[model samples]
Target: MKGRLFLIPVTLGSPDYRYVIPEKVLEIIISLRKFIVEDIRSARRFLRMIDPRFPIDESEFMILNKHTDYKDLDGMMSFLKEGSDTGLMSEAGIPGVADPGSDLVLQAHENGFRVIPLIGPSSIYLALMSSGLNGQNFAFNGYLPIKRADRIREIKNLQTMARRGQSQIFMETPYRNMKLLEDIAATLDNNIYLCIAANITHPDEYITTRTVSDWLKKGFPDIDKKPAIFIIGIKS
Candidate 1:
């Protein structure tokens, strides 16, 4: 009998998991003895935060990240192949979305393992909810180009889609957030609205939506070196 796979979600730097993670989900996280995680240190830290008495030293862990070799994915299923249920956890937020956890999930499915996704805070959805943008039809454009020239063109293309009523959602590495915001201010159309959601679910959380022109005149908060979500879409 092959074991099932549980997708674990972690807090968004809130420290208080009770608000974002379900009690049952925390219980499931505590029950697991083996895990496939993006970062071993942070995963262990999250488990410890969930329950101080959790058997950290005894728990088995396999590192899975963007750097993980594809050839080694099948080997990650060894525990499941042995009928031992394992959990797949992300550094933050839920597993799979915009994270390397999706690769392992795909391997698990192809190997015939039951996959269970637990309910938890998703920054993408949360940002959309508060951004006052089109929630029904939207696309998550994970990350834009690193080069300024390439990024400007990408933002323009996404803005074009926004005019048609489909929201364009994207994010950037924490350190580069300020640069991305500056580019958005200069490149995005003033008529369309722009939303910048930073430090989501954290104590210093900030989410705001306004016209590009308004933002340019009023300026905005300092979101430098912070995790953020940027959305460009029509208000109506």
Candidate 2:
């Protein structure tokens, strides 16, 4: 019995070649046996949208989310121990990046399961490419602190790195994008360049680069309720 795992990233709901899963990758999904998804419901919806004929049964799906309890983890581990080939899929984007699938991957690896990641859309790298910032060196700070003071302190430290020509990237829940933008405007220097890449690969996608001051004056764009990524760069 051989234990195997596949990391599948669901970029947007569609399978566009540019920034979402490529055509070749779509074939991989059709052949997978077991699916370990962040949100089993959402994963099912996405799969239906991609291809209505996709053979994914609800029973074969396993939920591995952040809020998963110990019992769930133990059950999943037991399933993996039976030499099952599993597929890890996030609600959106690649598994193990900003998703809870990272822990599952680590656990699988520790248990001697073979882990393979298929290339797909990553908003972090896409934001970096379009940010017009220092691409040679960059760090994805993941999500920022929720508390005002802590977030400010974290941004200040990130500001220091940006000033030295390091690109700093981070994201927030879709609904909190405006709040995150406001914080950046208030705390970051006027001259620092900021890039807001929203809804990447989506129908109404937007990517813009401007100074913090200019962004403040113009007010944050009407991003509505869409997934977005933010990148900040301080002139060296």
Q: How far is 80's C-alpha from truth in model 1 (Å)?
A: 0.8
* Strongest candidate by lDDT: 1
Q: Name the weakest run of 10 consecutive residues (lDDT summed) in model 1.
A: 8-17
lDDT for each candidate structure: 0.93, 0.81
Residue 223 error, candidate 1, Å = 0.2
By TM-score, who's the top model here? 1
Clashing pairs in 2: none
TM-score of each: 0.98, 0.90
Per-prediction tally of clashes = 0, 0
Model 1: how far residue 171 lies from native, Å? 0.3
lDDT of model 2, residue 92 = 76
Cα deviation in Å at residue 151, candidate 2? Answer: 2.1
Worst 10 residues of 2 by lDDT: 11-20
Candidate 2 ranges beyond 4 A from true positions? 14-19, 70-74
